[model samples]
Target: MYNSQEIVSISNRNIPSLITLPAELVYSILDNLDMLTILISFCNVCKRLKNITNTYHRYKTFTILNLTHHRINEQEFECLVNTLQNNKTLIEIHLRCNKIDNQKTKSLTDVLKTNTILTTLVLSNNTISTDGAQYLANLLNNNKTLKELDLGWNQITSEGIRYIADALNNNHTLTILNLQINNLGNQGTQYLTNALENNRTLMTLILSNNCIDYEGAQYLANMLCKNKTLTTLILSDNRIGSQGVKYLANALYNNKTLTKLHLRLNRINSDGAKYLADALHNNNTLTELHLGWNDIGNQGVQYLSNALYNNHTLHILHLQYNKIDCIGAQYIADALQKNTTLRELYLACNKIKNQGAQYLLNILKNNQTLTTINIQSNKIDFHEIQYLIDILEKQRIQF
Candidate 1:
């Protein structure tokens, strides 16, 4: 047995001091850690480590500037903004669910004026009204590096959207913009549609859960007819009815650049589905279509199935929660036999019974292209599930 002094000597000899290591080696270890870990664990360990972590280049793409769930006050937010301004390497900043108002937004805009490396900024679930939006729009006029901006669930109304539209008319580097769950009525949508006519850089636009009516849908459809750069459009959970679907279908027949369209949780019915089917027969560029949670019944499924027999480019189809019955499943199963390009099919939460499940299982025996089929929450029995598992196991071996 050794004495206490000898034990201390042995432990000290075994454990080398991390602070005594070379600066280059310490930086190499800190470079592998994420921003949150570095900030929380190493930033306050010593002055030297904090300086080294601040200068690390790996933080260029550091995401999640999240203040949500943390009781951060104004002084802390200002300090954070100051730190961000000094570090010229950050690429993304997420300020979601932070309850930020116009006063807080001023600090962010001040940093945006000089920060040239940030490309994505998410300000979702805040209280940014017209004044805050104007500040951001003003920054957009000069900032050239920002490419993606998300302002979902904010208090942006038509007046606020107008400011953003005016900025978008001239800004060229922004490519993706998300404004979902705002108060963009017909007037605001018109402003955006008009701006899109001249803007050439934006590609993806999301307007889900907005109060856009059929008239507003008409404005966007008109833009789609002439806009050549936009490829993804999400308009889910709006009030666009069958009439709006007809207008969009007409535009889709002539437009050739859009590749993805999401119209989930709208008021579209069988008539709307028929109109979209007509458009699908002529449109060749669309590869993904989401029409989930609409009241498109068996009649609507029949129309879409007939269209899918000839449509070759569509690779993904989402028809979940649409009250589809066994006959509707049969129609889709028949289309799966003829449609070769479809790789994914989402049919969950419908009224598909055992017969529908059997029909799909039988089709799966020969369908080699389909990689995924979601049929959960249906009326399938235990035996049907077992049979499906057996068929999938066999297919796995065959492949």
Candidate 2:
């Protein structure tokens, strides 16, 4: 009994000193610690940190999955949702890899309806179906605080996309929406295009690797012609072949808001390239155009050179992995004498030889705006490499 009383006296002496430390310092110590372990271990520690009976903001960002990557049950999910709802300072919630279904969606919606300060919500790799998507859309329509919503790698089909489109029609605060790798096909793309046509708040939309083909390209291109809000449009790895390329080219002739366009891995051959080159002469807002890994060869290069004479808005042009030889290089070099806005030009991995490298060197001799030129992984000889290196060294010295 004497020994027990002595131990209790020592423990009582330590309690006051632990509490005497500043609250800010205590919170800062917890902040620097790894959040995943801290959140899981806090409940096991003494009552001060573990007691949700005291304050709610002790847990800001919830990651229910412990270090072992086990599934967090519905009860634990509800606890996290309630804790986040009670704490207004919660800014980011990452529920990645958790199999969240419709029932979980309701619990999440309840929390979202009350939480007004959340800015970034990541629900990737979850099993939220059409019903859950509809619930999320309803919550997003009125909530204006969220800025980024990532639903990538989810099996959200056309039905879910429709709900998202309806939500995007009125939700003006959201800036970045990433829905890549999802099975949103032509039907879903049409709904998204409709939303984009009327919604003017979104600035970046990434729809790569989603199997959206020529018809879907036309749907988005028609919207791009009139939307006047979107700046970056990524359509790589899609089957936007010759016809789709022409459709986008025609839209580019009048659309003045889009600045960057990614058309890599698309079957845009010389004929389609000619149409796009013609549009480049009239379009003035586009700054970056990526046409890598396509079939646009020497004929396409010649056509693009014709547009380069008058085009002044394009600053970066990527033409890697095309069958452009010395003849195509000469055409671009001739235009480089007069065209002035282009700064970065990527011609790597093309089957260009020493003659083509010499033509490019001649262009670099007189061109003023060219900054970084990538001619790597090509079949150029020693003489051509020496000449290009010498030119670059002389230009650096002058600058």
Candidate 3:
């Protein structure tokens, strides 16, 4: 009903318009905001803003979950999934600690069915069960872009692990899988070991805190003897006893592809240590060995010292909290004089006294290859620690 002049005047008045801003400038501002903030606050402001936020280039790595205790409700999860469907540039998604259950996982797996750009998916600390894992396993069967999948601290039991293991047999693109703190006992370990025997693309496997016993360890050891693609294996906090260590040691003598092995808190005693030491005498590909929190005493340290004197590829050794007394420290110190390839040594939380510290300091003063050495939480006094620090500083080393 207004006249032409009045309508023109109203339109010409001063007004703020985000749509008038250059697209490049808007993108620059959005680049500084977190994905959650953009998704929750900015995307639904208007059609223009939604279009700008949904641009795939703005989200190559989207992390929208609350890592703390804050829970994302079902509606927000649906919105996230819808956004993911539009983002063709997203390469990584981290949904850790989001309380995602089987129903919510369907939305994610549905997007993954056609997602060709996503390479990493982290769903750790969720409420996913056997059915949810089956959905993910089905996705793995045909998905070619996914390389890493972290399902740690979920409710996946032996049945769920079997489903994942079966999928792994056919999956050719996945390289890293994390199943830590799951309820995968000996039976689940058997399934995964069978998959490792034939799978060629998997490179790193983390199965820590899974309650795997000696039988499970034996199964994995048998697979290691023939598997060629696996490079790292973490079996920490499992109950693999001395017999399991012996089995793994026998495999290490012939395995050529594995570079890192973690057997921390596995109840390995001096006998197991001797077995590993004997295997190290012939092992050529292993570069990192973690045997912390075991019962390897002075005799075991002496055995490892002899092995270090001959091994050439070992670069990192962790022997922390293993009841290593001053006598054990002396053996390790003497071994350092002959081992030139070892670059990192962790000996913290031991019983190394003043004399033991002196032995370590004397060898470290002359050594040139060792870049990091941890000697904290031992019986070495403050003055001795300061002296060791001074010597390392003089040699430009780290402790």
Better of 2 and 3 by TM-score: 3
Model 2 error, position 170 (Å): 1.4
Candidate 3 per-residue lDDT over residues 234-281, each given as its tens digit: 999999988999999999989999999999999999999999999999
Clashing residue pairs in candidate 1 are: none
lDDT of 1 by residue, 11-110 (tens): 9988866666677888788868766656445655666766776666665446545555564567556667657656565677777888789878877888
Candidate 1: 10-residue stretch with minimal lDDT: 390-399
lDDT of 3 at 102: 90
Candidate 2, 1-399: lDDT as tens digits? 569889999888878554355666566666666654455444444556554423434454452333222466765676666555554555777776788777787788767865678887777777777888888888788677887787776778888989989999999888778787788888889999999998888887878777888899899888987797899888887888878888889999889789999999888899978988999989999999999999999999999989999999999999998888888888888888899999888888887777877777777777768886777766877463685667564542111
Which parts of model 1 have CA positions greater than 4 angstroms off? 1-68, 393-399
* TM-score per model over all chains: 0.86, 0.82, 0.88
Runs in model 3 lying further than 4 Å from the true structure: 1-34, 40-50, 54-70, 384-389, 394-399
Model 3 TM-score on a 0 to 1 scale: 0.88
Worst 10 residues of 2 by lDDT: 61-70
Candidates 1 and 2 compared by lDDT, better number: 1
Error of 3 at 317 (Å): 0.7
Top candidate when judged by TM-score against the true structure: 3
